[model samples]
Target: MMIANLTGMRSFLILGFPGLSPKHYGPVSALLFFIYLAIAIENIFILTFVIFEKSLQKPTYLVFCHLALNDLTFGTLTLPRIISKYWFGDSIISFYGCFTQMFFVHYLGSVTSFMLLVMTLDRFIAICIPLRYPVLMTNNIISVLCGFAWFIPLPLVVAIVLHALTLPFCKSNIIAQCYCDHISITSQACGENVKIVQVTTLCMAMVCLLLPLAFIVFSYISILVVILKMSNAAGRKRTLSTCTPQIFITCLFYLPRCFVYVSNTVGFSFSLDVRIFLILWYSLLPAAVNPIIYCFKTQAIKEMLKKRLRKTKIGIKIQLSY
Candidate 1:
């Protein structure tokens, strides 16, 4: 009732890293701004390369395109507002604004997790069942899978935000974390039933994180068995080479997340600062690093970059000759 009365007027104050000193806010905000810039530029580079390079159009790179786009959207949804909180002291976010941010944060996370699963499945099909790779995985099928990955999480996340909105927020309007999130927002709800929302959010997060992980585990195991049986050492090496980047990316995305959730479940505690650091570490670090992984680990992208450089150099040389 109270929350409804203040519907359009309701807003929340975001307190980013509550333990940090006022003096450090400038440095920290600058650092975050640069990181956000890097994430944007890197992911945009990948998307542009995938768009223009016909040679790179395949199931694997298609998934990379989706991952890059997801990272861009996720970073945009999360970083700038928090950056403002520290840099300009613009900490207030309105009711609908906070809910909108929370919805996309969870929604894009689910999309990334599913995108990783799709990457693993691409590898599984390529290595585990080589003959059917062409038939089982095609551009059209990849397109459909990408579509489902983005679409499937919409209803679940909407339900979460809607439920959170209905809860009476007679408690404090100050959010302790950097950005609006399901747990952070719901913690400020004033009612005994808030526990129900917490439990359900936890379950949803576990399913989103763990279910893709289970399939990833199964896919890798099958991939490994096939790789071990290959008579040709060169082929085995090549196969492992192809799988390694995705493996690095998978570990990057999932391991920190698992550690945090597991620590919470087992009664282990971190300082609020440390907990916030870990959340940002897992959420943002992967986006910053993923493009680097694709650029360095994938041979095709490397070759394309090399060709572009060579062309640039030749053009400069021709001008010098003139």
Candidate 2:
């Protein structure tokens, strides 16, 4: 039975994993449920801690704060409905609703790439131009840049979705992937306009992914050169240590994407199952792991978290004794 609202927009049935057996749906949904919870808890802890901690009110930490927020938003935006799909056999999403999800998915993804670029720039200045770092990249400047990162891609995303809406989705309402994305939705579109939409969206995605990535590589190379030239061993160690988390997280975010792009370019493609697995792996894994990286790598945050954990343990013990 097809359900539509007063607007007469048809609903799309999301196939979380097209190849998975019906019997496995329960386990898959349960796994995703836990991952969603982990993403939520870890990022929420980072956001909450950053907001309340006075000592962590620097531009660099604030950049991390923005990243944590982005991860949380991205997970929340993409996960719940799919979880519903597998857990309750509810795969239907309204046409406009699917488009809305698609827009935010791409938009948040663009913002994350830009934010990583911002972080690279932040590190570059702090390491290479230490003397002018204070005057050059102030908190307010970083704040404005982060604000721009989040909002600047809005129009492009909107335009892409708008163009997609113009396409006639007259046939299949079933999306093969877990969620509504540009590729999945546009594939359902009929007519010659489909190619145009695909090409345009691909071009936009390449720009969003590559441009910032180029700068990140350049900035990191410069940072590496600067680190190598440092005479003080401890200083170099400390500097590299600070960058470890970002480098790791950046790799987590970008490497899989680069692999997929390269595979596509070389006329090689993954099985649908592998492609879907890679998508979920790269998209959600980094968000869930980022907080752990920051917690352990940054001395201040690590110490603070340890103190909080100890306090919690003590409180639990006292409660149990009563």
Candidate 3:
């Protein structure tokens, strides 16, 4: 059998959903638009709050800022293209464009998993080794860690993208999801190299997803032991409260991701729509919920929001009087 040639310009048609109709696209697009908007606004607010509030300059809050920025970038890189696909029926993406999208999607996702690990370490230090935390998690140290989280994934993802580019994608031009990703794009290639792609992708997933997850679990376990040893109830409550948001966000990210990887590795049969939904859930849901969790759960952020609200109200009242 002769495989198609990959010598010319190629484009992909992103089928937003497998069974969705033209009539359903409108409502679905609107819903996704609002979700994207909400994710952007919430993350931007958190990022701005942390940047402006001098009191929030601690290592822990700085990690929050980093995560918020990650969420903002992740949502921006993904949702607009997807929204356009459903809203205007513009599903065609150029060859390079699809690869670019795939690169960033995996890159930022790996960065986020590492960021969660960083947060877990922050909490572990604050709770388990409180005396040394001030010395250990200095601004400079946190800066270096955050830089590592941001840049470390670049080379790995670049290697993956380079390998993917070598594969001949002449078999199909239709992506069965709202956006491009490593697995989705590579699966369309026509060659025996598919197994290589799958194995390499699974390896990347283990490195990017499972490694950080293990660190997070270990950090929390140590922290839990420390919390249990603490005799003061109030102190225990405060510590748990501070750690809750990160824990929730971690679960939001890793649980679905683990499921997707395990299912793929085991050849579990999931419907096309269900797989798409799982991908969207793991990718978008954490971005939407992270800021909400931080704002509602973190006392400092609540106070900052309240203070800002009061200032806005006072400015409005003065304007009306004038």
Q: Give the per-residue lDDT digits (tens) of candidate 3, residues 1-322.
A: 2224665237887876888888888899999999999999999988888888898888988999999999999999889888998898788888899999999999999999899888888888888888999899998899899999998888989999998888877776878888999878887886788779768976986798778888999999998888888899998888899899888988998888778878887999799988898899889999999999989888888898899899999999999999
Ranking by TM-score: 1, 3, 2
Off by over 4 Å in 3: 1-9, 263-268, 315-322
Residue pairs with backbone overlap in model 2: none
Model 2, CA-based lDDT: 0.89
lDDT of 1 at 116: 91
Q: Write the per-residue lDDT of candidate 1 for residues 239-281, one digit (tens) a residue.
A: 9999988999999999998898789989999999899889999
Error of 3 at 290 (Å): 0.7
Clashes of each: 0, 0, 0
Error of 3 at 157 (Å): 0.5
* True lDDT of residue 63, candidate 1: 96
Model 2: how far is 145 from its true place, Å? 1.1
Candidate 1 off by > 4 Å:
1-9
Which parts of model 2 are misplaced by more than 4 Å?
Answer: 1-9, 309-322
**Is 2 or 3 the stronger prediction by lDDT?**
2
lDDT of 2 by residue, 107-192 (tens): 99999999999988889999989899999899899999899888778888888899898887766677778888999988877778
